[model samples]
Target chain A: MSGEASKAIEPKVLWGGGRSPFSISYGKIMMWIFLVSDALTFGGLLVGLGFARHAAVTKGFAWPSSEQVFTHFPFTHEHLPLLYVAFMTFILIISSVTMVLAVEAGHRMDKKKVAFWLALTVVGGAIFLGSQVWEWSTFIAGPDGDITTWADNATLKQNFFLPISTEGGHAILGMEGPQAYAMFFFFITGFHGFHVFTGVVFNFIILMNVLAGTYEKRGHYEMVEKVGLYWHFIDLVWVFVFTFYYLV
Target chain B: MERDDIIEYSLHSHHSAEEGVKLRKKIYFVTALLSVITIIEVLVGVFISRSANEGTGLWEAIKMGYIVLTLIKAGYIVLVFMHLGDERKYFKWMILVPYILFLLYLIFIALNEAIAVGEGMKL
Candidate 1:
C-alpha cells in the first residue's frame, strides 16, 4: 500500500458526481427532490392559512368549527360531524395503501398483481377526487341560511342546527365574516384537490403502462415504484391539509 | 436479440405464493391501522365535543391533540408506504430535516405576523 494517499484529483470516473451518491436510483431521488419542493409550497399555503385564521380570531371574528363546515354527506340528511371528510381521508389513505401494494408487486415482477393493484389504486384516487368535488360543491353551496351583515364587510350565513349535529350547531361562514375564513379554505383546499386530481390521472396512466407490460420488458418495476412515490406524496400532503384546514 | 420489441412477456416469477400472501397481509395491516387511526381521530372530534363545547381552552387542547395525531399518521405513511423507515439514517435526515425546518420557520413567522397584525388592528 502507498504510504501517502494519492492526490485528490478531479473525479474522472463514475463518481464524477453525475450519478446519485445515494443508494437509490436517480429517478427516485428526483422524485424526492420534487416532493421536498412541493412540501414547501404546501407549507406556505398552510402558514398563510394560519396567519389568516389567527387574524380572524384576534379580530373577534367567529371561525366556524371544522365539524360544522364538513358535516354533510351525499344523500344523507343527518348531521354526522366530520363524517364526509373522514370518509374522504380514509379513501385517500386506502388509495395510498393500494399504491404501496402496487409498487411492491412491481418489485416482485408480478405483472398481473401489479396491474391489479395499480387499477385499484387508480380507482381509489378517482373516488377521492370525486369526493373532493362533492365536498367542494357542498362547501360552495354552503348552509341554507340568510345573510346577516355587520359593520365593515363581515357576514354570518348560518343554517339552523343540522339534524346530524350532536348539539344544536349553526353552520356559520361567508365572505363578509370577520375572518373571511371561507376564502382561505376554498383556495387552499381547491389547490390540494387539483393535486389529487392530477395524481388520479397520473395513477391511471401508470396503470395503463403496467397493464401493457412496459416494465416487464425492462425487467424492472421501477416505473411503478416511481409513480408510487408520487401517489404517497399526495397522501402525505393531504394529512397536513386535513390537519390545518379541518381538524386544527 | 431476435427482435426489437417495445414490450415482452415476463419469463420469470419474482415472488412465490407464500411471499405474495405475506405481502398481502402486510398491506391489509397497514390499511387497517390507517383506517383505525382515522376513525379514532373522527371519534375524538365527535365525542370530545361535549367538553370542548364548554370552553375555548378545552377546544384548543383538543386541536393540539389533533395536530399531534395527524403528525403521527403522516410520519407513519412516510415510514411504511414510502419505505423511508428502512433507509439509512443519513438519507432520512437529508429528506426530513429541510421539511422540519421549513415548517418551524413557517409557524414562527406566520404566528408572529398574526400577532403583529392583531395589535395593529387595535386602533
Candidate 2:
C-alpha cells in the first residue's frame, strides 16, 4: 500500500485546533465539551444537596439515615435496604462496559461487533431505567411503619425523639425533616435518571443504524464514538451520585 | 507526527498485536482494584455507623474519612478509566481543576450556612 493509502486506514483526528495529535472524532470532541457542561450542572445539584443537608443540620433538624428513607421495594411487603440501588449501580456499570466494547469494535471497523455491543448497552441501560423506577417508587413510599408529618413548630426534642429506622436494622428516634430531604433526593436523582433514560434511547437508535450498515457505507463510525462519549459521561455522573446520595 | 508514522510507531512499540491484549488486561485489573476499594468503603461506612449511633465527634471523623475516600475513587475513575490522564495537560486542567474548585466552594458555603443555622437555633 502507498503511504497515503496506509494513512487513510488510520482514524481521523477531530477537534482540538491541531494542538494535539489525539485522534478522536469531531463528534466525540463535541460530546466531551457537552459532558463538561453537564458535569457542572450535576455538581451544582450536588452542592445544592449538600447545602440542604447543612441547612437541616443548622436548623436543629436531625437528618434521617439514607438507609431508612430508601427502604422498601415495589410489589413486596419485605423491606430491602440498598439492594435495589446496588442493582441499579451494577446495571449501569455493565452498560458502560458494553459501550466501551462498542467503541473498541468501531476501532477495528467491525460494524457487526459494534452493533451487537451497542444493542447490549441499550438493554443494560433499559434495565437501569427500570431499576431507577423501582428505586423511585420505594423512595416515594417513605418509611414502612406509621408516618407522622410534624408541624413546623415541633420542638427539636420531640422531633429528635421520634422513632426512625437506621440502616443497621434498628429503630432510633430523634431524626427530623426526612420528608424534606426525601423531596430533594427524589428531584435531583430523578433528574439524573431521566438523563440516563434519554441517553439509552439515543444509543439504541445508533445501534439500529449500525445494524443497517449505514455507518459502514459512510466509511466511519463517528456517530458511535459520539454516543459513546455521552454514555460514559452518564456513567461518570452516576459515580458521584452513588457516593454523595448513597454512601456519604 | 504524520498519521502513518503514528500508526507505525504504535505497532512497532507493541512489537505484536498481543500488546493490545495486554493493555486490555491492565484496564480490567485497574477496574477490579477500584471496585474492591469501593466495596471496602461501603463496609467501613457500615461498620462505623453500627458503633457510632450517637453522632459523636469520632463518628464525624469517620464520615469525613468516607467522604475523602469517595473523592479519591471518583478521581481515579476520571483520571484512569476515562483516559483523562492520557489527554493533553490543558484538557485535563480544563475538565478537572474547575470541578475541584467548584466542589470546594460548594462545600465551604454549605458548612458555613449550616454552622450559622446551628448557632441561630441556640439563640
Candidate 3:
C-alpha cells in the first residue's frame, strides 16, 4: 500500500496493536483501568452515603456528627477524637510512600533495597489493618454504658453523649437518628476496611515474592511496581473515605 | 533471538545513594503535609462546630473547608503516590477528566436530592 493510503487506513493510538499509547506497560495500563473502575465504585458508595446523610438531616433526624461519634480512643476512656483514625491515615499514606520507594528501587534493579522498602510497606499495611480492627471493635461495642435518644431539638437541652457514670458509666445520650447514621457509617467504612484487609493480604504475598527473589530473577521488580499501584490506590481510597465518612 | 528494545533499563539517573536519600526526604515531606492537613481539619471540626451553632456561617464554612481540603489531599495523593503526574498530559487528562466530571455530576444530583428530601419533611 502507498504510505498515504496505509496511514489513512490505520487507526490511531488506541487501536494500534501492542501500542501502550502512554508509555505504560500493558500490565500497568490494565491496572490503571481496574483502579479507575474501582474508584467509581467508591464514588458511588460515597454519593449514596451522602444522600442518606442529607435525607436523615432533612427528615428532621439527628444525624450524628462524625467528630462525636468517632471520638473513641483506646485507653483513656475519654474522647480521643479522630486521633487514632488520623494515625491510621498517616500509616496508610506512609505505606504508600514506601511502596513508591520500592517501585523506584525496582527501577534501579536494587533487589535488596526493594525488599527493604517492600518489607516496610508490608509493616505499614499491617499496622493500618490492625488499627481498622481496633476501630471496628470500638464502633461495634458502642459507647460504654446506657444509651438515651432524643430528637434533634431535644439534643440542645441534653448535650451529654457519653455521660460519665458515678458507678460504672452513663449511657450515650445520642440524638434520635443514630440508627440511620450508624447504618451508613458501618456499611461504607466497613467496605473500605475490608479493602484494606485484602490489600494487606495482597501486599504480604508481594512481600513474599520479593523475599523469594522472584523479581530479582526476572531482572526487574516490575511486580513490585504493579503492586505499588494497587497499594497507592488503597491509600487514595482512604483519603476519600476519611473525607466523606469522617471529616464531612 | 532478537532483543526487545522496549525493555531497556530505566533511563532515570543510575542508582545513587543520594537518590535514595532524596526519595526519603520527599516521602517525609509528603507525610508532613498530610499530617498538617489532617490536624487542621480536626481542629476545625472540633473548635468551630463545638463553639458555634451548627447552622451558623462559620460552621458551614468549616464544613466546606473540610471538603475542599479533602479534595486537595486526594489530588496530592493521586499526583504523587500514584505517580499520575509523571504521566503524559494526554494520558493524565484522559484518565482523570472523566472521573472528575462524573463525580461532580454525582455530587450535584445528590445535593439536589438532599434539598428535596429536606423540603419534603416540612410537609
Candidate 4:
C-alpha cells in the first residue's frame, strides 16, 4: 500500500495559457502602465498651459519671459535666472545617478552599499524639493509695479493696479493677475515634488530593510530593484519638467 | 545532466556575466553622450534666442529644434538606460505605439483648443 501511494498518478494541468504579452516582471510592467497614465496627466497640464498662454497673447497681455519670472533666491535681493534652475537640474541628475548606483549595489547583494547610495539619493531628492519650494515662493510673490504696460504693434496701453509691490520693481504684465501661472506652477510642480518625496520615503524604507537584515534573510534584493524603478521614473519625469517648463 | 552539459552551462554562465558588464558600460557611455547633446541643445537655444528675438522665424525654428532635441534625449533614455531596446519587440510596440498615438492626439486637440480660445479672446 505504501509503495502504491508513493507511485500514485498526478493530475494533468495546462500551463502558460492566457498569458499577457504586456507582462514583464510584475513591478516593471506596473511601472510602465503607471508611466503611461502619468504621461497623459502631464500632457493635459502642458496643453492647458499652452492654451492659457495663447489666450493671454490674444488679449494683448504680454507673456512673461521664463528668465524674468523665475529670478529670485530665498533671503536674497540679488536676482538670478537660469543659474538657480540649472543648479536644481544638477541636483536632480545627481540623485538619478545615486539611484542607479543603489540598483547596481542591490544586484550584487551589497546591502551596505545599497543603503549608502539610497541615503544619498534621498538627500538629493530633499534638496530638490527645497529648491522647488523656493522657486514657487518666488513665483507667487508677483512683480512690483502698480502699473503694467501692454503693447502691440499699433498701440501701447497702461493698466493701473494696486501696488502689491514685493521686492523688485518689475511690473507684472498681462492677464488679470499672476494667479494663473502661480496655480499651474503649484499644481504641476507640486505633483511632481510629491512623487519625489514618496520615492525618497520608499528608498528610506528599503534602506531600513537592508539595515535590519531582512534582505539578507530573503537572500535577494528584488525589493530594492523594484523601488529603484520608482526612483528612476521620478527622475525621468523631472527631465521632462525641466525641458518643458524651464528650457523651452 | 551530463558532464559536457555541466561544462557548457558553466561556460554559458561565465560568458553572460561578462556580457552583462559590457552592457552596463555601454549604457553609461550612451548616458554621457545624451548629457552632452542636452548641453549642446541648451547652448544652441540660448544662442538662437540671443541672436533672434521672440516672434522671428529663426526663434520659432530654434523652439522647434529644442523640442526635437528633447524628444531625442527622451528616446535615448528610454531605449538605452531603461533597457527598452533590449525588450521583446511586441512589448516595445505595445507600450510605445499607444503612447505616440495618444501624444499626437493630445497635440492636435490642444492646438485646436488653443486656437479657438485665442480667437474667442480676440473677439
What's the lDDT for residue B91 in model 4? 64
- DockQ of the candidate models in sequence: 0.33, 0.23, 0.33, 0.21
Candidate 4 per-residue lDDT over residues B40-64, each given as its tens digit? 7655544444223777877777778
Share of the reference A-B contacts seen in candidate 2: 0.23
CA RMSD of each candidate after superposition: 8.5, 8.0, 7.7, 10.1
- Candidate 1 C-alpha lDDT tens digits along A25-105: 557668888888988998898888788767656655565677765667788667777888888888889889888888777
iRMS per model, in Å, is: 9.5, 6.8, 8.1, 11.1
Identify the candidate with maximal TM-score: 3
Off by over 4 Å in 1: A1-19, A142-179, B1-24, B50-56
Instruction: Report chain B TM per candidate.
Output: 0.71, 0.72, 0.79, 0.76
- Docking quality category of candidate 4 according to DockQ thresholds: incorrect
Clashing pairs in 1: A79-A164, A153-A176, A154-A176, A155-A176, A155-A177
Query: Which candidate would rank higher by lDDT, 1 or 4?
Result: 1
lDDT by residue for model 2 over B1-123, one digit each (tens)?
336323221121111235435645755765676567566765654554522454687767766776777677667656654556655555578767887787788778877886777677531
lDDT of each: 0.71, 0.64, 0.70, 0.62
When sorted by lDDT, best at the front, the candidate numbers are: 1, 3, 2, 4
Tens-place lDDT per residue, model 2, A150-248, is 333232222324344465876554334565565567777788888998898899889889988887776666677678768877877887787778766
Model 4 local distance difference test score? 0.62
Comparing 2 with 3 on lDDT, the higher-scoring candidate is 3
DockQ of 3: 0.33
